[model samples]
Target: MGEGIGFEQPETVENKGIADELGRVLESVPPKENYPPDRELQRSILDQLPENLVEELHAHLIVVEGGKEAESSAEESKLRGELFERLATAQYGRAEAGTQDPRLAEELSQELVQLMHDPRRFGLEEQIGGIRNPDLAFFKINDQGKVEIEAAGEVKLGLLTPRAAHQIGGGFREGTRKMVEVVNRMEKPEDSGLLAVAQSRTRGGYLSASENLKVKLIVPADRNPEKVKSLVNRGIFPREDYVRLLELLKNKDEVEILKSAFSRQEVAAMADHLIGKIRERYK
Candidate 1:
């Protein structure tokens, strides 16, 4: 694991039942089918800007969003300096002559402002890559008192359908891969009491026939054994990654935390804020 990529024992969080109520609110705010910004408008504006300005902004955007390193050439730096001087003089002249707005300039300015803001409320902007966030995480303190991931799992929102199983399985792979790395970094490289967990809204019928169905399907197990096995063979199932599935409904404290983190009202309010920002920007 990278020095910066270790997990911390999360502070005990207040559980306000966000997960339990998310489904009800989802009916109204439905997970946005998609949330990309107006790419055409952005490109059109960039086309008119000085190459230096556009290049600088693009590089800045990459760094801000992904922490990637981008170094500007000396020529580009000189060009940007010259453009800034020219713009300063132009602005002074415009101020002296009384302000006037050109449609293209105004449009370009608005687009730049939006880009600078990098609105993320509804996932409007592209996110950083190579980071996988798991739903449930287990942590253990090493002898040095560093909190490390013991076990973790990726969770899907619905019952274990073939699709959901595929997603969860993929998540399990990613989560366990990281878990393996974190464990290797431990001072005492023994098995961490941590175990990966998989879950869904309900266990569903597919997992109902397991010998220890009640414990394995902690939240609820799926009933389709054949599909589950198929998904597992396809490397989409987390069965091998985790010791077993965990039902959030059975883990009282975890259920509360899940609910609090995914509450309907909280999600709605966040979405509403982003929508309002978009409307105001476009209006």
Candidate 2:
């Protein structure tokens, strides 16, 4: 998206229920003593955040969300900077597997374990890339020891079906709006047991997408067999990338987090690097 379109960025949030859930999973976080404003870092992150999300950042005591000027305030700005960074980060979203396949189930289970240990968990933005949703946030202990880690990540882990993707294409915004509604209602946050993140509506006529409109999605187990493996055995629709995505999450060596951390340029580079590595690793 370009400037002047007037799209706001989304900010990190703490829904009480979501926080409690995270506490149960990860324990014993300490509190912060010196609250300082990381104005420079905040600015850089703000630049990455969608414009609409500007309000969220400023809402933070550390960030001046008041646009450039408030950001300059070297006073209370630092006092609250620690709190804000604890609350926000970028996360990667998981695609749905659509079955109880052992392999897929195992992958999701491992992801949950990682999510539990990670202070900052992020899911990639939907196909749009940079624009992120609340799926990556979690409740964890902060330096201040207050209830931290807000907006627990909840995703419909499934491979988009031709039919579902078509539905998503027709009403991308609408579908996302509904997904947000579901996430908002979720409070427990215990890895949500692989709720079929993807849902669909079949009824036509006199139908207005009732919340009842849902589809049977995959649930995670220890074993998730490939439903389409037979159809595309060797490097077909069952593209090695998806399989690799599942496997990488299980093994530490195969995957490497950029030491440089996340940046738009770095992410682009990672994508290219992954592409180049695919032939050698998957084939």
What TM-score do all the candidates reach, one by one? Answer: 0.26, 0.19
lDDT per residue for candidate 2 within 92-163, as digits (tens), equals: 222223322323323432343243333144232232232222223222222232221212332222233333
What lDDT score belongs to each candidate, Candidate 1 first?
Answer: 0.30, 0.30
Report how far off residue 114 is in candidate 2 (Å). Answer: 10
All candidates: CA RMSD (Å): 24.1, 22.5
Ten residues in sequence with the least summed lDDT for candidate 2: 198-207
Clashes of each: 19, 41
Which stretches of model 1 miss by more than 4 angstroms?
1-136, 153-163, 167-175, 182-257
